[model samples]
Target: MLTFEIMLEVDENKSLEGNVELVPQLTLDCVIFGFHGSSLKVLLLKWKGTEYYSLPGGTVKQEESLDDAAIRVLKERTGLDKIFLRQFYTFGKVERYDRESIRKKLAHLVNPDLWYKRPISVGYYALVDFEEVFPNPDLLSESCGWWDLSDVPELLFDHNEILEKALHALRLELSFQPVGLNLLPEKFTMPDMMRMYEAILGKKIDPRNFQKKILKSGIVIKLDEVKKGVAHKSPFLYKFDANKYEEVLKEGGLFFI
Candidate 1:
């Protein structure tokens, strides 16, 4: 039995290859959300030599803080050093520690004993600009890419439940958080923002009403520019006023969809 004190004394800054030490009985899973082509997407890693997929996740190093570990995992998978990330929940259900299932999927990649140790996982969600992410798989996975939220398949371990919880948390935040600042590009049309909201909220919004409410909040500013190179009439481009958005958030102003 590996004791907690023994696990904490292991070396830090080394790769996760062969008996690398990590904080005992604790891990994290990240649900990375992005928006593209009018669809909400989640980043997933395809296991090497298997058809199964899962969210990008990792264990906390002995010397690493939880936030630092999550940031490192996000950077590894998305190639983004910074983004909007938050801890929403902790999953420690006894049944979540499905050792046999983990063995079937990841035994060849990581220590077989790993699954038997840590059953608790900290759940985190991140919002990133879709176009900026260049997905990279970990050592155990062969491919990394996006899957539409509606199309995501059953994931390894309890990740599907984790993903569902993340989405639920995101929807709750949609009413007050400036989610678009991280998920959308610097410049986007009003419709693009609405689509992102609708996708996450799982419903449609009145375009005119959405425009009026969002503009009134002063979080977004209309530019003199319109989207270029489309056969149809181009929509005016809008950019988030980061300063004002933060100000409103500080003031507890509502962000209605």
Candidate 2:
């Protein structure tokens, strides 16, 4: 029942002096996923002048609702207001708190004392179009971009564990949800869709069986047109039947792979 409550766009340079109206000891960490061809990518922020990298995160403001804060932060980072965002977990292990690590990683940006207090972070994962996302770094980060999940380096804090938990949550929901619509283009072949599933699940799906199962779900509709200019047989393109997709999502158990 944990909801999204992150604040990635807050200007809180003086919060340590008790000036900013931020919710004490609460933060939001986002694990954004984007698909690029065959790879599942995660968005990360690189701290300036350091080898440290972390998920984009911020402290929640006292005035905004948790859901509102998450929506605003996601829109600020991805430049898309209607993308898929889900709060998967809340991480607050006592061992995960490391004040010195925070001070060391952000020495150049702000006074380390600013984040000395340990926070209970809410984790949210989002699915966005790889091409549509306009990655923007905040004041403390040097660059923001996608990293292939397999190649993700050692992250700051307990972020690696958070990322792993987020992925596990995503895979759990994949069979029952039309999450593909968020990661794929408007028009795509069944093969393209299957590949996306395979990428996330880390396995290849049987083509014939996948097609049959998906078609039976009634979430996608085959179009009259096929992919053009292919050397091999051009497969018919398909699109999500928005109404049917939403209906299936609402019903929940009806749709499965």
Candidate 3:
């Protein structure tokens, strides 16, 4: 288990500082969401010399856009490039900087005056192929890996809120986008698809009904191949038809399965 230590800075007024004084320094935090087996998880990095877990993030370079910075950060931390990443929301609360955990973790590197000032952060959310990504911790992080979304420990600053929002967005995307394809392999079985959907929706779907609905959707192309080495009869493997999937997305088709 990981434990985060909270440190508070005491000012002359002995009150937490406001964001008006700390808006100049900005950081970009990315919540990398992935699905493995029947579980949903997020990638988090452990900061060096700190016990806290944080989203894989970095500061924007002076010459770069926030998007580019996020990509760079993701590649550096997760060994993933050209992934499906998106900017979800910006978090700029005055109390964001006043958190005891943040103040303590950063106190040694910054002056007390600067530590108390609030810095606005732009939060980006990314959906990556988990098995394809090899997460690498950067210079600032001691380690990096996936943590089950439902089992995440205490996160630093306002990261908890950002992660929650990312999960909410993902659930909503399940209804609109062919998101399950991103999490699955190039070729997968019907049960594999059903498991991924059930993990995201957090419900027990009727297996037979699910198979019927998905087959009717006509977005899945059945291959002439069958999964090998099973005790029972082999199940046919299927892959998403990218063109048809896009058309369904454009038409806002419902994927009840």
TM-score of each: 0.89, 0.87, 0.83
Best candidate per TM-score, number?
1
Per-residue lDDT tens digits for candidate 1, residues 1-257, read 21121122212334366566687777889999999978999999997767899999988877789999999999999999988999989999888866677677666555445345545899999999999999999877788999999999999888999999999999888755778898999999999999998899889889898888888999999999999986799999999999898888778675553
Stretches of model 1 off by over 4 angstroms after superposition:
1-15, 18-20, 106-114, 255-257
TM-score for predicted model 1 compared with the true structure: 0.89
Report the lDDT tens digits of candidate 2 across residue range 1-257: 22323323323433433576887778899999999878899999987667789898776778877777778778878888897889999999887867676666655555546555567889999999899999987656778999999999999989999999999898988855568889988998898888888888888788898899879989899999999986789999999997888787777744233
lDDT of 3 by residue, 117-195 (tens): 6667888888788888898986556799999988899887788998888777777777677686777888889998888
Q: Number of clashing residue pairs in every model? A: 0, 0, 0
Output the worst ten-in-a-row residue range by lDDT, candidate 2: 1-10
Candidate-wise lDDT, in order: 0.84, 0.81, 0.76
Backbone clashes counted, model 2: 0
- Highest lDDT model number: 1
Candidate numbers, best TM-score first, in rank order: 1, 2, 3
Q: At residue 242, what lDDT does model 2 achieve?
A: 79
List candidate 2 segments past 4 Å from native.
Answer: 1-20, 251-257
Best to worst by lDDT, what's the order?
1, 2, 3
Between the candidate structures 2 and 3, which one is better when assessed by TM-score?
A: 2
